[model samples]
Target chain A: MSRAGEGHRVTMREVAQRAGVSVTTVSHVVNHKTEARIGPEARERVRQAVEELGYRPNALAKTLVQGTSPFIGLVADSIASTPFAGQIVHGAQEEAWRHGHVLLVTNTEGNQEAEERAIAMMLQYNVRGILYSRWYHREVEVPPALGETDSVLVNCYGRVGAGPAAVVPDEVDGGRRAAEILLRRGHRRIAFINTTTASPARSGRLQGYRQALAGAGIPVDEDLILEARPDQEGGYGIADDLLATGATGVCCHNDRMAMGLYDTIKERGLSIPQDLSVVGFDNQEVIAGHLHPSLSTVALPHYEMGAAGVRVLLGLQEVPAGGILTVPCPPVERDSVDGAAAPPTG
Target chain B: MSRAGEGHRVTMREVAQRAGVSVTTVSHVVNHKTEARIGPEARERVRQAVEELGYRPNALAKTLVQGTSPFIGLVADSIASTPFAGQIVHGAQEEAWRHGHVLLVTNTEGNQEAEERAIAMMLQYNVRGILYSRWYHREVEVPPALGETDSVLVNCYGRVGAGPAAVVPDEVDGGRRAAEILLRRGHRRIAFINTTTASPARSGRLQGYRQALAGAGIPVDEDLILEARPDQEGGYGIADDLLATGATGVCCHNDRMAMGLYDTIKERGLSIPQDLSVVGFDNQEVIAGHLHPSLSTVALPHYEMGAAGVRVLLGLQEVPAGGILTVPCPPVERDSVDGAAAPPTG
Candidate 1:
């Protein structure tokens, strides 16, 4: 070990000897425990000794004494690769810090072996709790090892009674909010651009769209509902079909799709919120805000979900059995939508 | 503690008793350290006993025995908020895992007190090494406490002899690469769109631009260089100034600015790579790829810097004293740059 390394390993005993006080006094001063019994001069001496010796209390020793580690393990699918979803890690970490806990994050990148290994490692460290998160909202198979630890799921859910508490975005509500935004702008004929694949988000958002139109007493136009890959290319590929439907408003499954739709609209010489109004889900800042006329969309409340997951894991909040919670997705109104123009008269 | 927690606390002693082997044999089997003396049958018995009893060796105890922790600490300014830079954390964490180490990440968000607190906490756990990183590449003040530990800086540097090893993107080289791409495409009348700030990136990139132009024996035209805010609005704001210069190609500080320049060129009734060629730095996927003519730009080596930082901190690679290392930034060729139009006939 280097000199610096040796210096870092300074023992509390050294501080106690230097301060001419008992080891308990040094411990009390360092841990900020009750020091009232110690005289002021002794306490000051202990503090000075600690500073001079650079003595840091061993977290490992503390954990063994307290029977709980001041660390929470966050097992993420791939926070670094996910652009917007990284907020989940940030929110959970900040929340952990607020409770005097540090987060130990590991990215499994969707590998089952890695997930199991990470969970096992966290258990070895006696992490107070674990937050298992996915890069995107979806179903996940909870690692069996995770069952042996206090844990919560973020942005993902597992089979009932298989995992700990989970907090996820309310995709259905987000879909409804997107439709409602268009509807509030007086567009009775709203089209929904959904994903071709079967996903919780796809189905949930579709359900919300249907419910919103049904509540508005508008006859559901099956022809206006289109399915494509939930990306820019998918939206671009389906643009002609979307325009052909004659719907004045379009609600996309995500911001990427909406951006692609925006490109097609501009290429066709149609103006945004003038010839058509567009709304997208997931208020991805880079995509939504950078769009020419900005995208009005639904915000996924990822921060709230992450914070809630940590709270549940730390016992700061209670969760119902089978441990699934959905945080609301709110509407973020931007320049992408406006009141529908009066119907063209012959 | 829950039943699961109690089960997780099962000791190696119990595993050894169950396997009918000595504690030392069980330790050797579990740690995969010098098990050659133990018969295969004994190893199999220990493994089975461990699995059956759910015995997990405490990392804290293991650290005490090994004199080092199998964990690295990453203290970041704000990873989640930085879109593309998240790759840095990902790369570091992945590399750490490859070496049988996990990264414990904490975000300070530029709060000095939080930084000190985070560093102190990591020291308490005796992290094997620390990777101190910032969201953007710039000079940073090395927290005095960091000197007491094995550490490295990623995407940021510190005062001379003031901190640990550092790995940062070679911004000057990136700028030169951006200019070289345009020059290779037959653009000598290239304009450099620089940032209006006194940032290291701005000055370093400008220096590279000048060096490239000078190396090519092209007289540096003062009129060809312009300053902007290094964002879309800034690029848009300088549209007329850039156009009036009659430059055949433009190199922007970043992709956002290039996208703005693209819009301006198109709105001016000009075609990309036909009327004018464009190049940008930092191949930001959302902005660069989504442009009509995808941006040709320089890629910041954030991932490499992060991985290298970890390697240096772990002593897996050597770094010069004073601890400054520069990773290469390569050019990502796209459709944005093309042969400059033949010099206008007099």
Candidate 2:
């Protein structure tokens, strides 16, 4: 067996000599430069010589002549630590491949220095474009280096008309969809359990919930809206308060919180969709599908956002500079919610 | 704002003129060729001129001269779909960066054609090394292109001495540790709940369970061992049979199964530590830590394996060709297990 990095590097000149063809003919064949014509017999000889010698075309040399690298750069804020956002990289890689490009990826872990350094490295490589992304959908301070590159932002937003294009999830629409799922099931006295922290997702989702309530001729009951730590424990802690409001249905900030609510409801001798119905955001399959009744939630459009970012960067889609493209977050209906049980008690 | 890909390509001549120096002097400064003699004042002028002009040293030109590319390649199988393995990419990227090389990554989704294509692309880029990995620990037919590149296998193994090195988890040791955790808690009657499918994890864990029982002077009861689907439903379905064996404790195949067991035990009006103690494998935080009593389990060393693969490929560590490195899986003690409550009825 041949070992890599241990043998003398094979040269194109050697391949040309072995094939009895000019170096230019070998170069044209190796680089896929189809404009240059060569006899069929010579092409076959060159191919066989290349194969026998295990010759690999140097991309760096090709880039110097072509004025473009065959690589795209991806600078992720925190890919490994956040499982929910892994699809973003997957989407970007697939899109880049479709266009005959490979991805050079860097995980900065939210370090500003690392982010700048990554961008600089991409620039040095002369990558055709760069994709800047975060683990979640939110506003980001555009990296200063982005001003020097053809870049797109994923799962994040930047300044309007900024040099880089932005692709983000339609959080407000997702929120409205969550509320509409509950309202359509005939629950007007529905309550929303949101995160205690101030975030775009929190505000956008709440706004959508309000819009759905207003469109249905139901007056907003501010008292029914509550906040929690956004985990199972938080959901467990606020369960009594949620039930005391007498709302037959509830929309949670995320699936983790919804799971916690399930525990409290089961402990109180209540059945899902019967005594109480629940809807959640972020339809994480493992948590949502594994629940006793399964969870009805909103799905984050991570894959679409990632694919879109690459498309916009590659000019496959037209996106205005500094403009944000909002991808829709659709509902993944499960067995958690049902039609309204009884009229509102309050 | 200067948009990337739409501006005039800056040349070293322009930077040299701006710095009032020769192009050769500017080139020496930009490429960090310390052997060249240049005064501090001239070097500072070159640096400022390069930064002001936003001149990027051509990596392609440098690679053609140096005979090596400044990047490493990683080909992953289904990274986004399997969140548990995100750490593998993270560890690889970090290690690559520490060595002043960036990572070019691709996700093949287990397609033989795609895997071969990805490797071919990586080779074109002249990557210094390639790290081929999978989402799970299993045997994989080595890609044919691997013979032409420096590569290592992570979380998976290939043909012995097939030229590529391998780094994988020590599954047998992990299983032994899991059974030891249960036995140390004074549980003489312990049942092993494993997967119905034939897998390395299942067989390795079962062997460890037998070893622990033998060392404790206890006979291995065939009836006490059971096989299920290795999921929540499978665990739930096998719960009745598990309890009927009169075992005081259970060592589950994985956390998902243990969670199902928790559901069954709860439905039977039994407490976790008081009525039946449980230990699980793969301390996946979402499932293991979120359980009511929290699950005590063993953690697969994915991050370590990933980091080690890169180290071996970069020649930072010595690993014999075709050698497999087994990393230890440590126990993550949580709240699930406790001292045995009573003697086994059987």
Candidate 3:
């Protein structure tokens, strides 16, 4: 609405000439390139001249000529409310910047329509690729145009006309890691609790839990597996059910659910790592560190997943269709898990 | 290097004529605006025709003519690493989308140069406005061009020069609310622990603490006030220092430092609310819910600020230069704070 050239219109060419540098140098300065070393005095001069001249560089003119930007688009599903989603965006942005790309991000509030709108807008801007993300499990019906674009789905796997790869955490691997930690503590009565909402992540984690117990030569108890909501309250309510079933160790689907378990443990006059040891997935910092005993959980390296998403979009990595790239989940041990002393045998 | 027409190229105009509608009507369908009342069969015909033709609408032309976009750009200091930053972004994106505006987001890693670069990129894309965000306290030197553009700064109190308006949590008001809560619970010996970092927020919160105590006729003890680094270790180190001074209720700067206090309290074998009542700012879900007694905290309405930022950028509100629009902070009561059965009788 505020049209330029209303008064004195200063151009980028003039700033370049005044600074005794090429237009490219001025462009780099405007774009904030770290590699370009402009002296303090020169930097000041350019700043002053630009300030005095009222020069605003045209981003479209510069980038349009370049044909494509190193910038990738990351369209997340409501990170402002959820912390985990933010970590994914952060990871993606860091990687994009390090690899000479800026992220063009958007948030779709778990609405299919909104997602379609965001994708359309990003494509219009001609972003190099997209990183479609969701906090919970849901089917991401990729827009038709998305088939022609390069995108990687984070935390969810999707097929876009046999193109557009998805980079998701190995939920099964994460579950197995939690089980292994519990088994190492010499606990056989370990319980697995997850949200009732059905998705690949939940089922995959369940499979891993069963497999881990089998590998440890312990028979799996179906009764120990509790399906709850995906939040702290969900975990809290289900913890009582687990303790009632005489479970000593618990593996939560994610950190929020784990936090809930702590509440139930505290209310029931039980202590962590002593009465009940807890393990969770998704090493969210606030969830991992804030608890009284400090929850020992599995870290799904969201930052790596984000970086990987960008790499997939840039064709830096050959992502096979239908072959989901599941990154390994590592257990972060805190004070939550207390192992039983070994029995005298042999 | 994938040239249009080199591979199968499908333009929108062809699809429009084939669908027996104007190009504008076809655009409405593609953009998912169903106000035209095209029958289901017609819609299906358009989808089939699009599939058959490989029609990809030309976004470049549409954007140029529009001059303004439905996309609102959000630029944060750093998103990936910070906890609350993601929540703030989510809030803004939610509000933006609700208002039929798509969000265009970028991260600046707290680098002034990177911030400027991100701003330029947003401008080129012709976003409706920009939302500049900060998760922590830092002296932000805004680029000059931002003043001329429609933009708003988040978690920022004041501006250096002529710039867009800022939306930050009313730290002083929030602090006042926290103090009021403590006062109601019959706590007189309250201690304020803040970061020594030279930031407006830190100083502003300190002022609020002083103001609240003064207003309540409770003598402010200088010795009870302590400064530490803004992290878990910082909180842990300062817990002993505060407790040693005989303060009954402690208010931490943010949730992060408060978490450290939980660890220190446990190490000291101190029970929460009974031995020492701890109140933290920023109702970080991880901190507020995971603690033994669940720490009581002030939740900054990040979503409200985000929605307000959009309003400011859209010229829905007019603010004075160097002035700030403080978003309200509300207290979330949990188990951490234990008050007397009744208020003390004067």
Candidate 4:
């Protein structure tokens, strides 16, 4: 441990004295208030002094005077532990830094007591606001301690008129884009493989699949829609049944499912696009990008949700109380989707 | 945004009034200094008042009196954005919380200016210590401003007598274990596939592999050793050459490489643990677990590295100046290793 200068804090007054200027001039320059016209040379000297002294205006002092520190708090269930959801923290942190505030995240890993304790710590830190986030999209009961500050939910929602605003990825739009890609590629018989679990992603994607079919003037085939456990094993378990339907195009619930189907279908003497064009959701880069053919899928917009959550907190974006800000999930085209049509073999 | 009670700070006076005790008694109880022996009834009342009022002792007051806040600062290159490295944050946070200190991380994405600014901010916040971390294992230059406080590097090393201590994963032992598993499984002829890129992981693991073979009295076969890109493509490209070596067991550089080898070798009509037993490193669950046979691989102690980093920072663990603590990487057994040895076929 390098214990040099432990517990030493350089004061603004020191920066002012080093720059040969009044403390008031240093304060105005540091905070960017500059109500009085301070000359450029004085401002440059103050900046140089601050840099040379490695001086930082005290965060504690700022909180004491302004009632809050320039810190945006993000408390999540498992954002730090869960790999796929980490982009949320990255986005929020980038946006917060852009706004001259630091973003601090505390992951409670779904422990109720930890959540409350983390929120209380944020309040003690005098954070500007809290971004209550879940690792995945779901309806969440806002923690009571969060009422002490301006907070908005990310990747989750709550009942109307009962909690803070939310920023979530638009599942329906994501699903629609997945199916429309196959539809526009001249594939009429598209199979929608949805999760067995009842959630916005499952229901919304199925609706979008059917909507795309209806728009194409092609009647919805009930047998073409298959239900699985929303994982690779589930996709593998339902593969034979899927091949029996013989749809030319397949839209999976997520990238994990697509990966499973890819393994099984390839094992059965079939290959993606050459045998059937496949589109997936949640575009998890590890599974999607590394797959043999490289899956084309709909992204989850997790980064956008995190940025939008900060925007909503900072009043840069609007969301009525209990309203949802559904960020768009754009399609990431890769090698999986083939424009050359294949024959249907139902 | 829920703006309820925004900027509200509950004070000791408010808690004293609610608990019917003097400010001095409340202060002693809150700060956990029991110099004045207070009654149990008074303590219970104070606890209740503190909980009900949510009267957290102001952080500024603590910093002013003690010269440092109860916060462990972790500044990393990309712990949050990089999925494999997130366990570092999780482990550090849990340890910090266990010691009644909060862990706040700032990801600078390896920008020098941002790194300096983040370090300066930590000084302003009066952090107890900073855990300077890198996303991957390598040598890192100690940031200049990091000299202001006690600091340690995580998963990276530095010049002795010039920088703080470091804690890194035991890649050599991990590689040795990977080969030992194959050797213990009654396999004589074994091939080790390492990354072409030169790094601690690459060199250390290879050294371990040679050591394992040497311990077993098996002569190292130069032709059996191959190198390629560290990803799946690299693994796949080397599969045919690996088969030509006539080795019954194959050790991979990482899980992604193992995945690539699995695809190609399976395509070539070979099966794991049956025709060839394979083991991988960096037990990335997404790839190693989801593969059809479920890969047996070495697990990187990312979580342990983080916890150890905090222990070093808090002076709970001894890491001599510029010393390296090599944490073990445990082997995760699955279906990839089969003890029922098959014949070596070229």
lDDT of each: 0.82, 0.82, 0.74, 0.82
lDDT of 3 by residue, B1-346 (tens): 2323312335677887777767776777887886777778778777766766666665655554554556678887756666567767777877787677777677766677777777776766666778888886455666655654577888774446545578888778888877777777888888889887877668877888888899889889998889998777788888668877787788888888887887667566666787778888888755577666788888887777877888777777666556578777998988888873321111
**Residues B1-346 of candidate 2: C-alpha lDDT, one tens digit per residue:** 3322442456899899999999999999998899999999999999988878788887768877888777788888876776656778888878888888878778777778888888888887777888999877887888877767788889888866565788888888888788888889888899899898876787877888888788889999999999998888888888778888998999899998987877667766677877888999888756788887878999988778888988999889887444888889999998998898873231
Tell me the chain A TM-score of model 4: 0.87
Cα deviation at B78, candidate 1, in Å, is 2.2
Residues B1-346 of candidate 4 have per-residue lDDT tens digits of 3222654667789889999999999999999997779999999999989888767777667766776678888887874456565777888888899988898887787788878778877777778889988877887778767777778789888876666779998988998999998888788888889898878999999999999999999999988898978888898899778888888888999888988888887777677778888899887746788887888899888888889999988889987544888899888888988774654454
Candidate 4 lDDT tens digits, A1-346: 3222544656778889989999999999998986778999999999998888767777766767776578899987875456555778878888898898888778787888888888988887778899999877888888877777788999988876777888988888888899999988888878899998878788888888888888889999999999998878877777777878878889999888888888887777776888888888887856788788889999888778888999999999988545888888899988898774654342
Candidate number of the best DockQ: 2
Q: Could you arrange the candidates by TM-score from highest to lowest?
A: 2, 1, 4, 3
Residues A222-320, candidate 1, lDDT per residue (tens digit)? Answer: 998998888887777787888778888989999989877776677666778888899998888667776767789999887788789889887888776
Deviation in angstroms for B227 in model 2? 1.4
**Candidate 2 fraction of reference contacts recovered:** 0.53
TM-score of chain B of each: 0.89, 0.91, 0.83, 0.87
Query: What tens-digit string does per-residue lDDT give for candidate 1 at B197-268?
Result: 777799889889998998888988989999998777777777788887889898999888887776566666
Candidate 3 collision pairs: A80-B87, A80-B90, A90-B80
DockQ of each: 0.48, 0.54, 0.28, 0.47
